[model samples]
Target chain A: MSEQLTGADILIRALEHEDVEIIFGVPGGAILRAYDSLYDSSIRHVLARHEQGGGHMAAGYAHATGRVGVTFATSGPGATNLITPLADAYMDSIPVVAITGQVGSRSIGLDAFQEAHTWGISMPATKHNYLVTQVDEIASTIREAFHIASTGRPGPVLVDITKDALIGKAPWRGPGQLDLPGYKPSVKGHPRQVTSAIEMILGSQRPVLYAGGGIIRAGASEELLAFATQQNLPVVTTLMARGAIPDSNPLTLGMSGMHGTYTASTAMQRSDLLVTIGARFDDRVTGDPALFAPEAKVIHVDVDPAEIGKIRNADIPIVGDAKAVLGQLIEAGERALEGAPAPERSEWFSTIAAWQRDFPLAYDQQPDRPILQQYVIDELSKRTDADTIVIAGVGQHQMWASQFWGFEKPNTWINSGGLGTMGFAVPAAIGAQAGMPDTTVIAIDGDGCFQMTFQELITAAVEKIPVKIAVMNNANLGMVRQWQKIFYDNRYSATELSSSIPNIVMLAEALGCAGLRAESPEEVVPTIEKALAINDRPVVMEFVCDPDAMVFPMIKAGGSNDEILMGPEDL
Target chain B: MQHVISVTVENKPGVLARVSSMFARRDFNIHSLTVGPTEDPKRSRMTVVVDGPEMEQIVKQLYKLIHTLKVVEHVPGEAVEREIMLVRVNAEAQRRGEILDAATIFEAKAVDVGAQTITFEVVGEPSRLADFLEIMKTYGIVSLVKSGRIVLAKDTKSATKKQRKSA
Candidate 1:
């Protein structure tokens, strides 16, 4: 044990022991001591204009690097602002550790200045939270927070440190053993369950491999590709699992859900078996749980046992890490198939192919029409390569980016999926860029989403992180407008925003960023190329897209997958 | 369906709140919950009875909490359970003797006596407690309180098998 150090010093030491390289945060009164200690530490700190931005930037770093990201904020309003990103991380199962400073220990329940009941408020939003008033507990609490955040079913964990603790002294015991008896994450699937899952896979004919964000989190994309190829299985990745398997692969189907491709949606509905790997059957993906895949028997493989039967009943449940489970599944499947006849799935492939050919993710891009969002996405995709990491803010532009970008690598596509948090792209892109300095990071955002968190451009410029921002400027909340047009009979309530205010170009200039605009099809490629060319600081490009554009091949919110709408005409 | 789930958790601050909040957020209707010190001083055991279609989900939810050390479900035919009920009955000059006679049949003890009311404490299986309450109703039940249940799995050995089984 080393000489006693201040709680703030121990906190920084603990983070250093965890091999943390970067921290995204905005300093305030409550966390001033922590900031002072961090200033002398080796970990780089990226100052965000808002706590929410800091939180999301950490999430983006995790999404890009497959590591537990860290963020810091002060108490009261500062901690409250982090709620959205915490909730987002919770919903998406991203690994993030957020540290917040609380009021002094004595003033805890008295609602002292800059104090909030963040411990209670963050309980449901975080995987776990700690309120440490004692100085000796700082290291242990931070250690446990990182452990909880990065372990099974990874999610955000919060550690609220009282101001007294930050200034108090504690002996430095470097990286003590975790007293977490209840937090064991199952890594290897049970042998019997693995065998049962293999049996289900062997017995099925029209099997579709449904992958999700857990695949990325578990680093199971390679296993997913191998198993799908070996079994001749068709794969349908969800929005979060876009690049789990290469979109160019013949057996791989595109994203499935509300704005899913027609082929992927149809295949899921008709498959005899859904080999769900690391994906929860969210209501958005299921449409209606009662009617989803009526003929399919599900084999759910997840790290979290609670997720097994939460939404859809699994015929075979394998609770373990996805990577380890997939490896187990591969060996078991090969042994079972040594003498048995291979499953005949030619007809199923043909059926899926026919749907793919007929629908083919088509869009109405007439030369006469103003710049189409779909066309811009395709242009950007063409300009960028597999190494380029794409972050999307939630909306029509998000769908267009996912649908059009031919992702061939894992961790290449990141977005706010489960929580659907808008304005995630701006700070997240900066965070991703910070993590992968050599790789290009682009935020394909909607006009509405861009406006929500665009202030982060200053952070990007100040940090000299060269992330490209492509705003599909439609001047309206495209998804909500589409919903209003279809379901609400076009009331269009408070969805439209003025296009002229703080013009995108001038705003980028003010924030010390290069800005360009593309209005027609001819200007699309040149404008994206121009944005990509600038590498010293952030660049923002406005793609003037048609306001009337809508995401197609959508399944109605609560409607059955069988009743999917191909376009506006079907609606 | 109702399930009797026993969860072993670390004796930490806000642990009960973490568990209770999980149940509320997950939309589980808890019937009765009892928590106290366990054999190990560092741990506490919580006996929760909840009504739901998905008992497995309830069990999984309990196990998901970071403080939850262990979770055991006491299946209906395999476990013995008990609850304590305290009932205050209106005892007039005419009904005082009758109320005492009814309490005697339930093996209840007169814990307190007031001007016109007699409070009896009874401990038994939850159903038996309910039956005793029903009998006390004839004397006009003034007030009643029921403690959360505590349960233990039956021993495999035949030595302690009781002559009467609880419903």
Candidate 2:
């Protein structure tokens, strides 16, 4: 009545049950059995350079495909390495599954070789975790892991299977009736809460819709658009929620954050009512928690109950999946708007349009002056259509890209937002390119952030993914140096870089990629054009810029939203 | 509204912090808490009393926390609960049997017997258990150990599959 199966067999079968198409992972000694079983399964395995890279790769793939991305690692360092990525995914609320191989059940706790307390370490990062000692429990554990990872307010789940469980022969029952007594993911919205939110929106004169990533993940974008159009309400998206409404849609205001479009940010600030869907109010998006949406009565809707009023007060909090909740709201809106005239907000719309015209994000780079990072990103964005995916590394370059490089959609701009993980860009771009092979992948990296994982150039070349990389070579940790200059009275202190890296052009050539350098504004557009023309292999363009540049309009940590610091304003 | 509930759980990673954070983020007021390993090394239990304005909100949060597998059961102490409190009282050697008789009357078992001290293990619902310990206070209580409040449904088997089936 039982089939002879290793723990790996059960794991793969569990993943198959969850309809996972691909998994990203790196093999290690303790985890070889899982790889062996994976060799036979239909699921595609992407071999990444490091376990952390594997984690980001999985996250990028998940973000792109809207399915939970799965990854595996060996015990000890392998498990520890995946921790940062797990934390990043958790903060961003992306669904992922990280399966780590553990030391054999017998060798655990003896200070065994390559043994780390993975379950304990990843406890805070994962939505849930399982340490399987018994081989018979593997299938159920994995089944539960997927259920937890993809359920209410999806997040990363870790399953640490011991080596014995992976190698040992067991009768796999094929994930039979998983009954975890305490785990329940709510799939439906509270009827009363949803009705109240819809009522408030209907009653308001100046109402705005703030959509987040949850809309896309819930597959509710169409519902959102229908509701917005029917009600004739303007919609704004968080950076993560970008493609929920197409940027070209007249009702859509690009993105709302620190560098969010003036129209969207102003509208959010002035609206009588704001309906937040599937978006956590990240600090970057909400400049100061207390002052954010001060004039607006907030209606926060999300799948996770804990997120409601965690930072900001919610006048009406609807707990449910965004799509389900939106569906209900749309139905209510349809019923209410029958033969009714649309509410007028002509004056408010005119005021917001005026702000957009006056404060449009524009920097005129002198054609004769040395190239700036902003100029490079602007040129790249101008040449490329909105279809390109732009992944950024942490530093001044990342800030510049966020401020200047226009993103028409979410998942198109991938970066570690809350965790501020550096060395994220290249691997993330690699993963994004892998996920969407037809789309152009661009990694906007600083000189400092590029060196963190530049070795991944080999990954791009090997995978034959023609990703375009624009390196803003400022020769310093520019963002830190900017803080030092402004806050620490110009004490540079460990921020400067005197050493030279392999001239990026030569490095790109060595890695079998087309290398180009742009040191002037005129060269910026031409370089991007030249690089995009030759798409057979990957290309890396190095743009040299002033090392002392800073991202403008920055509200320092612990500073008020009104106290924004534009560059050189102190001077 | 305030409710004091104890939960029996499997000692595992992130369980305590997760439960605590859930309460903190939900703005639930936690009045008192005590957590320790149980008689079974494989399991740990926690007793938490939360005071908040809304009873339903607190219960919903508790339900969510209880859904984590580490949490075996969370039940209100006033409803159906037990605390096995061990009290070591200083008793004259001659009066040991009398104390034993008292322990028998209280339905307590003698866990430790000594020359001048008699220790009794009392397991009952919280109120009865507290009465037994209060009586022991008259005997010059030397020390006491309590298993906090390990709770169960008044009708355990019935509630497990009945009310919680959808959960």
Which candidate gets the maximum TM-score versus the true structure?
1
C-alpha lDDT of all candidate models, in order: 0.89, 0.77
Model 1 clash tally, residue pairs:
0
Best by lDDT: 1
Worst 10 residues of 1 chain A by lDDT: A339-348
Q: Each prediction's DockQ?
A: 0.38, 0.25
Model 1 regions more than 4 Å off: A339-344, B157-167
Error of 2 at A280 (Å): 1.9
Residue pairs that clash (backbone atoms under 3 angstroms), model 2: A182-B67, A243-A410
Fnat across every predicted model, in order: 0.53, 0.30
Q: What is the lDDT of residue A3 in candidate 2?
A: 77
lDDT tens readout by residue for model 1, A1-571: 6698898999999999999999999999989999999989999999999999999999999999999899999999999999999999999999999999999999988979988999999999999999999999988888898988998899999999999999999789886458887788888888998888888887788899999889999999999988887677999999999999999999889988788998888899999999998899988788989999999999999998889889999999888899999999888878988955567688888899899888889776787779999898898898888889999999899998999999999999999999999999999998899999999999999889999999899999999998999999988999999999998999999999876765999899899899999888888889988988899989999988898878888889988988878877887
C-alpha root-mean-square deviation, candidate 1: 3.3
- Clash count for each candidate, listed in order shown: 0, 2
State model 1's lDDT: 0.89
Clashes of 2: 2
